[model samples]
Target: MRNGGCCPKLDPLPGEEESAVRTSHWRKELERRRDSVERETDGSNMKTATRKKDGEKEVRAMAPLAPQLCSRLAQKAMMRSSVTKSMASRDRVRFNVGGQLFETTSTTLANAGRDSMLGALLDDSWNPGQPEYFLDRNPACFSVLLDLLRTGALHIPANVPQKLLYREALYYGLLDHVRNAKWGPFDGNRLRLADSVPGRAPGDGTAIRAAPDGGCCVAHGSVVHVYNWMLEERRPISLDYQQVNDVGYIDADSIVITARERLGRAEGGMAVFSAATGELQHRFRVEHGQQPKSFTAGALSLAGPDDNRIFSSCKGRLNEYGIGMWDLNTGQQGDFFYELPGCSLGDADILQWLPSKNCLMVATLFPRTDNCFIGLLDFRAKTIPWSWSDAGIVVTLEDKRVLHAIAMEDGHSICVINQYEDLGFIDLRAGTGTNSAGTGVRWSSRSKLMNRKVPFEESCYPKLATHNGQLFSCMNDSISVFSGSEHVLTSTLSRSYGGSICDFSIGGDRLFALHNEDNVFDVWETSPSPII
Candidate 1:
């Protein structure tokens, strides 16, 4: 044998023909062994090839992911989605909130919508390399928000402060979801009657008014009593020989009371009294003629730029009704008092007086009929600009139920409620055509109030009053408080009065409810929740 370069090259020695024969025999044996080895490793090689193909298939299958799929699942569960330990680090997210650690699917965080902080963080266009989020907020509160996002529901803890939770919700842009959670009826704990005062007379309270200076006036039987916010008696006027219809404040220190003499000379009149002292400041006698009238029809309202002029709806002659104006300072009557074209006022109630527009809202009921009329008396135009009767509104709706309406603070919209608990709005500004035939008034589609319970006939007649951009209505024993531009019920107060409410008034952030049975007056202070 001899070596040629690095490989060994066999050289035939002695006999060339014999060496060639031996080399051929060795080549044949080498081929046989090679074939045996290939056969032995066939199964192992096949498995290796199959595994490589499977790995490539998996990579192809996972190349694309749905943007919000992870979040949707977590939301449905009302909690964070759990990932396996074998999941890639990029698919999972860890959060450190106030020293608390939370593990969730990255897709779940992205489901908060692109506008939210979590969504922004998960957005690859903005946060390309983010793997974990650390929030400087209450972890417990964040958990609640997470559950809300996951479950489309909200569960607040007993120990948590709602204001603080609301703040967090706003910070995270979850206020809409949180506000929707509070959309149902109001809780009983929202509005609470804080004080009660027994009436001086044994008669039931007919009317109540909240004064400008945080005091209240109540008319029970033939007596009017004034009380401060603390329900302490300040003044009491015993009008045993008179029939009082309504009481209101002319100024912080003075109040105007409307009453009719019930004794020998049956005449209706308005008297001014000092709220500080129970002394009568002035008395303006009403002269409607002596015709032995069955019932009196008039409502007292103060107008003018300084709210010094008084406007009254009075029946001038038999079966004739008109609006009367009087100067409170000078006690002088206006030159002209306009009367509605063909309507007669039986029991007139002055709803509101807009000094800026110089308009007065009045609700009139016919003497012995189910007809109710609401009109706007524009002092600037010196006419009853617009009016609507129950019959006029009934033609517009399918359900012809008994309806009670109130003038909204906007001076254009009227809030109406019917016996069937249907709540709707009438647009006074949308009044079209001439006032000759009373053609124009638009009604909104009906909806229910905050009360989920079915309304009864007794509670159906909910009395509505507004204060500080909020509306208060006394329905049965509960007083509902609605506030905001949309007028959603923030809460309700349950009255402790033993009887049904005869009258209720909201003034100076105070709510007054009068019991129909024992003449007990319950007063509640408005504490509205913050708008979300």
Candidate 2:
């Protein structure tokens, strides 16, 4: 064969030429297959690139809607979470108390105050999944207290004992609620007779002092009977027949008792005792000539709530007659106001500390002496700036003897009451430069309008007290309440059972009146306002 191309080609034998042609055909076939595969691959690659570019374009086109979708999903999640919390907060709670079931809301439990046991249930630890709470308590009392939490009113069933209810109330921290619902805040004009306790001995209650915790102590001869707010006697303070002169509360837990000096032993004086235990805490001693002298303490007076000084009238054998001040915290003597010539400090029946004027009012009322003497002693200056006495004043039919006196809250005047139910006022501003004997008292006959139908066998001296800008006076078997700026007689409180009222004390939003006949004492409390 001739080679027509520019390059020369070599000829082969017949069989070899056939074989070579088959080989050439096989190689061309393989090349053609490779080229076809490469074309298919290129087509596939181009299609894949186009699909990727389309996916990217689609992603770019949807970019603005992505944030809106995410925000909508977030809002939906927040709404679900808030709904869950709201449902949890509004979920009802059940309490299985003493096998009794109680159902209440979280808001109702919250009204019990966070410090209370029921209110504590609203805390986070209280699982909302919890179906019921169990409390092993008196169910009846629990029911009453739960009602109190619901309605802010306490109603005890007839079967439930008051003491048992009180115990439950204390356990639930609802005693204040119960007390408020029962007695309410003290209003002198809206007083009601709550209870009466008979004395240990008839006509033996010498003095009745009120406690800060709505308790009281009655001095019966040498023994002092202390009663709590529930009228339950705690302990009797006895002085071993030494005769208790006066008793006052240094605080809610402590009581200072003044007893007459023993005849020869010189042991009876002023001692502070525990109101609950009746144990002696400390003894107040008077020192004269640098030696502890045996003395007798009289009326007790506290400086003020912020002050720690206690003042007591002291009398001794030598010359220890004066007002002795002692540090109530340390029981050490602070200072002594020696008895002045015209002012009888030792025999003062009433000693009141005036914080506004920074002075002490010492009054030696009648029956203790032939005349009455009321003097304001400034301890800093050691001078009687103002005083009033009925010494030289002529006694007339219209002038009644001043039995009891109390300084007004304003510190401008002193209120005095007589046995004939006459109210008098002594102006402190008018008698600035005058002597105690020359200070005149203005008497008012407004209280005399309330007349008694019949006279009693025993005469009860009237007492005067100023509280919440109102005046309280107890005469005979009744107590008169005076109100307004002029102190007009507005209301009268009288009881039929107890005889003539001997003494009355106003404290802790309650009034305690001690009667003379049966040694009975009456409790008066103000009613709460109606809930709207």
Candidate 3:
């Protein structure tokens, strides 16, 4: 076209000949610009150089620019840098973990939420340093935690102990991670079932009594089996009765028992047995001058080691309901050994004996009401010096709360268990004798909602037992130990061999557990460890 002549007649070379020159010239220009940009952005102060076509090095001085032009260029460069940083923050996060570098996507960590340590560190609202996070933790353990965050699963190495891994997971609030990894109880490693012994009878284990002579007495049906420390069968005493309420050792070989008549053939009474000879030493009728009484529904507790007297709760005509006494040698029963002062206690039972204080701790249920009472018998005064009723515990806690109680080592305080599986202490030393409005004694709650894994209605009544100044509570299949001084829970033994516990006792430096399985019992002792 003639237009090219007017513009000075530039002509295209034929085919590849023209393309070759154009490509070579443009490649040189691109290389020059690239080298200049690299020099500006490389963050180095040294002057750069270029090579000429003759292969000789040519020094290039970066020319100083006008102040306004340089300022505009700097602003554009800063905007680009900020945009790059924003994109990186949205896509991923970087961490300097214990000097070890790590990176992951933002969404991966957000799944655990900001409450977790990792999420808190990555939170943009509070943390302006989004590109890099630093954590002072074991890199090896941190790697495991990060993997859990990314994959929603914890894959711990074989060399890492689970306990150590658990500790790290807890620190990161990743306990739920491990919990989701495992099912059932999380305390399998904390407690162990040491030993279990089969029950000696058919109907669930009723009671386990540890004798003073290192022997254990297990009661079922009408017989009590005594076992030496080695689980060897000592003489088994078979009582001539239908039901045996309770049994305890009066001496190394002699034991006392409370029972009822089988079909009303014989008088239901308290009897003594000789473990060494399997002989019926004596039997005292649980009656008041020919008025047949029943002790089968009640409990028994020894008066004193040498007093040769035992206390029992006897049921008879409404007028004869009271606590009875038995003289081991005289074979005599006291009708009104100690009755409720003004009114007849609906139902009373001796729960424990405080030899040091010469007092008997008793539990009574008020008639026609859900109210219950815990009384302390001052043997010297022959009356109840202090008593606590359900109304007195807590007005809001008036729903048959207390089921059983045990005198603490102090003798002035009693540890009680409620129907709700809660443990509390009642101070008997502060109460006035009358306590008309249920304000005589004071109750302080401790270890509430224990046995949370098993509800009270689904399990047997939790039992309380104390030994060596330590308060032990048999809740469900486990035993909770509390410091007698502060009433704070110190330890929990939740391992049950196989069945639900019906009763338990602590004595003879051993813990005896009676499960619902017929004739099944377990023994536990603290394994020695360094005091420090």
Candidate 4:
């Protein structure tokens, strides 16, 4: 008898494809945007001649150009579908945001604190005109676009293979899109992120900076070793692999694995790997120490400007003191941004970073305090250079087994209000005090989407992973995957080859972990054993 086991992704029945088809709606808006830019630029050029008055200098607009041609060379922008007396009957583009409908030829969105890794997907296509143009796009996609527009380069997470993303960008000529804004897929009606992303070494390896998995620092006398519970079986087949002063966790196939120990340095520090198999990619340590005079550096941000990249306040006084920047492409330490005047050393954690405002939103609970303060740390100015403003409430992940990811503001903090846990969303944008929140995620539509709230603990084994559409989590030895009410689970190997299951971290659709008696790390797929 095949003993069944549960894992973290959805395995649709027999031959049924278990992946989520919930693609972000892109075509309709792309059509509207393309039409608008063309018309606006072309019309404006035409109007420039008409709008010019008697006294005004000849303010000639840019010369007109065709849509596809203009897109390739930037002669003009795509025309928007709009109207004048000649086109009064033309229908306008409609946008639905957070359930509100608006009649705007185009939409604009503010992506202050969205995930930058996701932003990287939008980076290839440049010169997209403006952020408002993609307003009707998915919030996550829009946020990334807004981030790139504001910061020039979008931040990629360390876990994603830079090569894979680069390949996707290169394939779609994302660079052209970024440069012209006119670059669309073959359809010519949608803003396309690449069609074929290179498969992950272990498939679907996204950034884990925000996974429920947190690093466990074990002190062997003076030296501190970083370890994570590999619930499944992973490489290096050890109870807990040592981080070796390596402040971040790269993807399963780390481009470079540096096992170096930098004493006290930030810029120009070198990292050395014993095995060179996949070793240290770059060099740069974060500044450490404390207030007053100055502080020496040590740690680095786990991910990047995005919340996934974070500061490892693991050193003395400065351990949790300042912020460190970890590059996703390369595991090198980029730069360090420390906190000032504020008491975030231990209590505060970066929930997310608002690239638009250059602000760091942290979730911290200070002493002499009953509530946790989700403060916004702005590093835009000089001098002490940091300001603190409170986000309505505090949130945290209570699971000891599962890894934790927290994003403060917009609506979520530690969780994305999905089928997994008591994760709730407070829509601050609605102006409703802190009380208004969304319950279980839109799991499926067959029923009410959400019926009753089970205790958060019961949601364990709650295989959690999100790709283009579905949100997944596991329960016990079973893996449950869901998208609205349309979801399923696959039970394969069940009977425990026992030992306290260390952990379960998912990337691409693969889960990595090490069990009790196994010295080898195991990789499990959402489906059976094949990569779809």
TM-score, one value per model: 0.55, 0.81, 0.56, 0.35
Window of ten residues with lowest summed lDDT in model 3: 182-191
Model 4 C-alpha lDDT per residue in residues 37-117, reported as the tens digit of each score = 999999998788666762253323233434555576543222232224213322223335334444422112222212333
Lowest lDDT sum, 10 consecutive residues, model 2, at 447-456
TM-score winner, 3 or 4: 3
TM-score of 2: 0.81
Clashes of each: 4, 0, 5, 78
> CA lDDT of each candidate?
0.65, 0.85, 0.67, 0.34
What are the per-residue Cα lDDT tens digits for candidate 1 across 241-272? 57777788886688887776454454555678
lDDT of 3 by residue, 1-532 (tens): 5665586666666687778989999999999999999978664433232224223322222234456678999999999999998777666778888899998877778876778876775555745445687878777887888887776655678987666776777788876665454322212123345467786577766678876544588988888888865566777877754578778878777778777645545456677888766688887676566765554435787776667777777665445566676677777875355465553342564367787667777775433235667777765567776677755444554453666778887777777776556776666666544356264334444434332433534566778877667777776677777774776677877553556677887655567788774458876654322225
Better of 1 and 2 by lDDT: 2
User: What alpha-carbon RMSD in Å does predicted model 3 have with respect to the real structure?
Assistant: 23.8
Clashing pairs in 2: none
Assess candidate 1 and give its TM-score to the true structure. 0.55
Candidate number with greatest lDDT: 2
Best by TM-score: 2
Candidate 2 stretches with Cα past 4 Å from truth are: 1-91, 113-115, 120-129, 394-399, 432-439, 451-456
Q: If both were scored by TM-score, which would come out higher, candidate 2 or candidate 4?
A: 2
TM-score computed on alpha carbons, candidate 4: 0.35
Tell me the lDDT of candidate 1: 0.65
What's the CA error at residue 151 for candidate 3, in Å? 57
Error of 3 at 17 (Å): 99
* Worst lDDT 10-window in candidate 1: 432-441
